[model samples]
Target: MQEILRKGLEEMIMKEALKKVLPLVGSVAMLAACGNGGNKANKEAGKTDHNGVAKFNMKVEHEGKPIKGGELRYALVSDDPIKGLFNPALCQDQSDQDVVNFMFDDIFIVDSNNHLTNDGLAKYKVDKDARTVTVTFPKGAKWSDGQPLTVDDYIFTHEFIANKDYPGVRYPSSVGPLVGAEEYHSGKAANISGIEKKDDQTVVLHYKQMNPSIEISGGDLLSYVIPKHVYENIPMNKVMSHDASRKNVVGNGPFKIESLIPGESVTLVANENFYKGRPKVDKITIDVVSSKNIISEMKNGNYDIAGMPADQYDAYKDAANFSVIGKPAYSYSYIGFKLGKWSNEKGANVMDPNAKMNNKKLRQAMAYALDNDQIAKKFYKGTRFSANSLIPPVFKEYNKDTPEYNYNPKKAKKLLDEAGYKDKDGDGFREDPNGKPLVIKYATMAGGQNDQTLALAYVQFWEKIGLKVELTTGRPIEFQAFYDKVEHDDPEIDVYSAAWGTGTDPDPSGLYGEHEKFNMTRYVSDEHTALLKDISSDKSFDEAHRKAAFDKWQNFAHEEAFAIPTLYRTGITAVNKRVKYYDLVSGSEDTKARLYNLQLTQSKPVGE
Candidate 1:
């Protein structure tokens, strides 16, 4: 197995190097002045002691004493409201995870080592067949309102989310391995016979086949046990949309929502009667602020934790009071082409009347055009990896053997010329077969400074190949609207940016499989579809088999010209040095940072 893995990795590197021999492709700050007395005061506070080093141990001292309170103030970046506390059903953005991580606990949670362990409410055991799993709740587990939490909560959550009436809420992956779960979720079966209540506190899940991924997915990390008492009375539609439902929903976790101010802030206070001892901090407040203000707020000590994008890391990494940690996120950014528009029914290229991109050779030539390494080094400032595969590197199943498109402008121009795209009218831009200009509009989120910069860089690179590229930017919401309007239902836009962030368990089914709703590029092949199916259903949990399957899929995607991967983001967290008990854990899929192991220092003030 070790040899196989090593060989696979070598193949990956070789393929990446063979793709392109691309063309060849910053700042200081003032020191703060301090008086002798002020320096003495800072030394006394323990703030300046840990400067210039990254601390791995989770211990801290403040003012020559151990601080006890563990209060944290975070900032929200968007206004999407969280609709549910249930994990499989939770679909809100980053802020929702922020609130849910504290308000509710999972059945089996991943520790710092990425190993799954029983936490919160249940102890689980798997039968020899690996098909039947049993769970028992801790005797004293109870909701915030003091009602006993039982097996029924878990069963109800499984049933509710599987119901077709919920539409978008169905998490078939979480329950599909169980007997009758797929049928029930797809509306072909009335109920899931596999879920049985063994007793008051015990539940059993029976599956038709052996599946470890299902077991991982069934655990609390993805499955949040819902409150049966609150849900039983609310109408299904109202359950998600009703204000009363959101206000009164009860959960079993360390904290409870004290107040929520919509787009501004959310406050949570530790639940004194929490089954587990109350969290050390009295409260956690998350305030909404724009990305531009995040660093300034952190510098002034208005916030204790903030997330800085990769491009901004160098500007803030030198701060004496801050620590920066970077890890691979579940997200990757890529450029997708409009295939439907390329093959117009009227047989005319809608965007470029010459239809230069309609030729697969031309598209492949464009794919190998830009130098990804140069982009990563020059634009990303070494904060991100040059992604060659659709699967981000964070996943164990990611195909490291996949070939990468190297940056070679000369090769790109040669391919274009061979494919018959030429400046026929001597206008300095290539033309399609129909004698129309080969100009394309690249769409991106309008106001994001980093995205805009990246788009501009791409435009410059594509123009070198005699391609006329135009830039179109929209607000985040408007950009999504334009994407759906043009790329999905129609094919007016030539290229656009899209990203996918997987959960802890990396499954590409929703994004790459046949009939995938999110496969916006509409690139499909039998080989790619078969590989995705094999990976999804393979039962041995063999890492090599999965990697090989994905490797083939990546090769197919590259040959078919589905999308051009730009960068795989490295998750970054910027926190004040005084904050203690925070550790970065590996494994799992959700990108929101985990705080289960976090605790405040014993001697610091609430904000200090």
Candidate 2:
């Protein structure tokens, strides 16, 4: 059972090689960002609903004849600097993903319905009877480095993440379903026995049991392929910072990394050998710009396309130079309470029954005290709205209109009084149930113009309900630092506010499962576990049963109050009129808007 431990003893000595290569945190900082796609057809802007959310057109049509070739100047709207982990397996930060999207393609294409289609680099066939998924890559596919993209590359991607020494957060949920994955990950098996290679371009994944989750990208299947010839010999710990992952990264996507400036910018040239065909543009440059400066930069024609921050939508909405294209994103901002600590040895969350914020009524009260609607209207204008459940409405098939905590100070105070949290010290703030002073430390990321204002407003909301909540570190933390503190369960943080970028699959297990490191709140419950399993279980093949499970989980999570949904975003992009083709509709089946088909009406972005 422990044979795997001995197989990698020599690799332990090579772990220090990463320190010589690059500092771990700095390397991660170089590789974090976001990405979105759009459609080309509806030239008109969308209308705002009563919830203050503007329903933008999913498709847009621009008038212009596409010219031969030019450069695309893209901007990643973020106040945080990019962390350079360019590898698809290691890059999880949305900001870094924005850059990665230009260089890497998914192994299988997922359509608007969140179902996998045979329109990508490879085709797949799932056999429930055999509990195996077979992926076949066509012979012609080649990496940007002119190397063959074989089945071993796909198999290597899973092995890299499942390796015990690998330090990424994707291990538990991403590859756990593969048979022997746990044994390989826990040092019990020499190698994953389930990843079988039939030929150079064919790989079969044998799962312990197949479920409906595998129907989408976020399932046990590897979403992106890595070049095995590049990183097979590198130490697992050093792979993230290796030149192959950063400066000289290679992929089979439409673009190839031409130059990278660490945390600031990246320039990519067309991959002539791209499976989809050579990209229409000569080169593409992605710059990391502060969200506050995005609007102004778009006005000055400094960008061909830029992610427009929700808070700045009003300023850019009517700008003649660019059009505001948007669609509902599979993401939500939420406030989570630390109810337990993660047990690394157990590889599971250990919920503490006596944690300070463990009282259900206290959490409920805090949720009720938040005026998310007001924040949506005041700060985001018509771009975002208060969220009702962890499952964003974009997953229309599963997301239900469940009961939610609206701004109700009266109910909040009532719940607090019933829970025995009162101002026992004669101070306005409430005391714990034991008559002790209660203070909740909150942490939020620093970004955009209204970030601080919104944080202060949340603090004030809790104050109004007699709960004393203060910011951790006395202020909002930087993007990387914020996640570092949250993931590590920093003692100063009792609560935190953050957003989640969901995958094409509607399963929440990756984010909230007991063994998931992405479950920052470290919450666990018997019902929660069972509900999650039911959502992905074989029985979930029945549409009614799956939806009921999702509905039940949302209600249960809401009632538990471990995580309170705050806002659902409208992903808004400002595209210059000179751009001939660009898409904002995520996970669409249309290939015309892909980089390979991108065109420019003019040599440079032009302001109206």
lDDT of each: 0.55, 0.75
Model 1 over residues 1-608: C-alpha lDDT tens digits? Answer: 22332332222111010001100000000000000021122222212112221222121222222256567676543323323332325332333454555666666655444445565357777783556778787777788788888888888878876675653323444555678876886679878889888898888888776543544432222346777777767676665565534545467777777887764676888876576577666787877655556667777777666556444555665555655544455567777776543232331222333333446667767777776665555444455557888777776767777777787778888888887788999988889756777777766543233334445556767877888888653322343354456434344466776655555555565555444334556555567667767766544357677667667777777777767777776555555555553334432332122343344443332332
State residue 585's C-alpha deviation in candidate 1, in Å.
1.2
Candidate 2: misplaced stretches above 4 Å? 1-46, 586-589
Q: Score candidate 2 by lDDT.
A: 0.75
How well is each residue in 185-211 modelled by candidate 2, as lDDT tens digits? 999998899888899888889998777
Against the true structure, candidate 2 reaches a TM-score of 0.91
Report how far residue 558 has shifted in candidate 2, in Å: 0.8
Give the worst 10-residue stretch by lDDT in candidate 1. Answer: 26-35
Give Cα distance to truth, residue 511, candidate 2, Å. 0.4
Q: Assess candidate 1 and give its TM-score to the true structure.
A: 0.77
TM-score per model over all chains: 0.77, 0.91
